[model samples]
Target: LSPSTGHRSIRTSSKPRPAKPCDPKSPCCRRSLTIDLDQSNNALDFVIYPRQFDIGECIGSCDTSGSSLQYTQAKNDQQKNKPHAAYNLVFLHHHGRNNNSLAATRNHRADKESSRCCSFSRTGGLELTYTTTVNGPIIKKYIPNMTVESCRCGLPATIQQV
Candidate 1:
């Protein structure tokens, strides 16, 4: 994505690819994903600015070896309630045990059973102005969480059987 305008790139001849595949030890990260709204195969009739834009995607394998500390910086003016029509995020959490009891080990094994996936940690959006049909009325829409800002290895469920 463009650092200046926060807009994505226009279409190019060749698409970008990751240098190498991610492994279990690799950190979950973001990769550029350029989307062409006007691709020949697309069934839409709108002309979008930043014709080709990067929404990005998550890549890498989730580390299942040992746990580590994660710190999050809170926004000073974070909103208590998000704006209307915002995307809802579901986060899976691991229940860590302090003791290494047999039951704890069993729970840990169960936790491992639930594999983690590379997922979005933070996200933003872009405003898209398009017409429903060719020469149709122009509409401007702000899509929330349409772009991946950061990524992490996370569980996919809100509840886990311990």
Candidate 2:
């Protein structure tokens, strides 16, 4: 009997692979940054930087039981000792109230109410209104061969691809 020639011969092909570095400089490496302004459980302004490929722009008003505004920037700089490629700008305004009573002992109950109302008016009825815009500048030094795009917040978003 002929030695097992029944097994089919396997054939393989070798193709040359493209040469390229995996970590080419790109916006994909940059992190999204955000800034927020809030008051009495309400958001006044929320803006995202590098708006392209991200959500950006928020405007509203809130009453002040108490209010707070905060700003933060985040980005991934692959190279050590390099500053983040994004920045955030914000402007905020707070309102002040007036007091009606200054008497020391004109009916203790009435005095208490007056003080309470004064303090309450200071922050209990705060109104915050604003408009927000985002601008993103290309960090050419980071990605030499690509252009950055501008993006706005909403459905059916658009992005300029490099």
Candidate 3:
């Protein structure tokens, strides 16, 4: 496929686009990146099927301050009545309960060692037909974790290894 056929450029007017309202529930999410294997500048010799394909990527902020998309119902419920700063357990424990009396206590202590990032929580594979040379035979290969299946806000070190 030619460069133009592999990727298309969008023509826009001078007018600016209206700003989209910020969504409180929107946190780190997946967006697609178009891969053009047959592009003129692409030096890949493999003849990938579907010359142009979209491989999803993670985008957006990792700040979960007002975002519910990354949290579960149980987590949200815990946030409603948070624990005391000094105590590792909840206030109810002082009365007559155990540490587990409330939801699991979070280590609110900021991790200075590493910062959170928008990363892939899950990953999939892409099966494409490729050839060693221009006239070589087509071979189907499943590249492990070649595609982004899902995304989440987490430490870069905690990203799942394919």
Candidate 4:
């Protein structure tokens, strides 16, 4: 991926050989910025409160508010100001700055291009970390998966899972 842009995500690269095969001058080995948000949880990697999402999985999942919310900046915000979009998931950030709600609303209107994305889920759930010989569709397993059920089985009559 380009350091300035998070595009060109390699799901899986060649297996680590005894020697480095990449040439710095080639586009394949171009400079890349590895954003390790989940690992380091750095501030720059997160969106400041003034530019946070109002209601979404990214912020609410943290279950924080106020000064606590300040500390709860979303790592997903980094993607917001980018000139390009991520391969699969796109994160839209809500403006949380101190200003009139009406103005803020207009500025960050949903119809705005910047507001468009896959979702506000900070995790984006792109498991771009797996290292193996596998690549492409096979690397999809890295992304987080969720299971849902409408009702419980073999339980009391009134008991329901959903």
Report how far off residue 37 is in candidate 3 (Å): 2.3
lDDT of 4 by residue, 1-162 (tens): 668897765333222112223343322211122333344445433322212211111111221222333223422453353323232112122232233477656765542433222232222122233323434332323332111111111111121111
Query: For model 4, how big is the CA root-mean-square deviation?
Result: 20.3
Scored by CA lDDT, what does every candidate get? 0.49, 0.22, 0.47, 0.26
- TM-score, model 3 to reference: 0.50
Question: What is every candidate's alpha-carbon RMSD to the true fold?
Answer: 14.0, 26.3, 17.7, 20.3
Q: Can you write out model 3's per-residue Cα lDDT over 1-162, one digit (the tens) per residue?
A: 349588543322212122233346867666655566666455655657757655555555654464444334423443453321112112212422333332333422343212345555665555667888778778876655455556666643222323
Error of 3 at 115 (Å): 0.4
TM-score of each: 0.50, 0.13, 0.50, 0.16
User: Candidate 1: which stretches are off by over 4 Å?
Assistant: 1-26, 65-109, 112-114, 157-162
lDDT of 4: 0.26
Candidate 3 residue-wise lDDT at 55 = 55
Ranking by TM-score: 1, 3, 4, 2
The superposed Cα distance between candidate 3 and the true structure at residue 100, in angstroms, equals 32
Candidate 1 lDDT score relative to the true structure: 0.49
Once fitted onto the true fold, the runs of candidate 4 whose alpha carbons sit more than 4 angstroms away are 1-33, 36-100, 106-114, 119-162
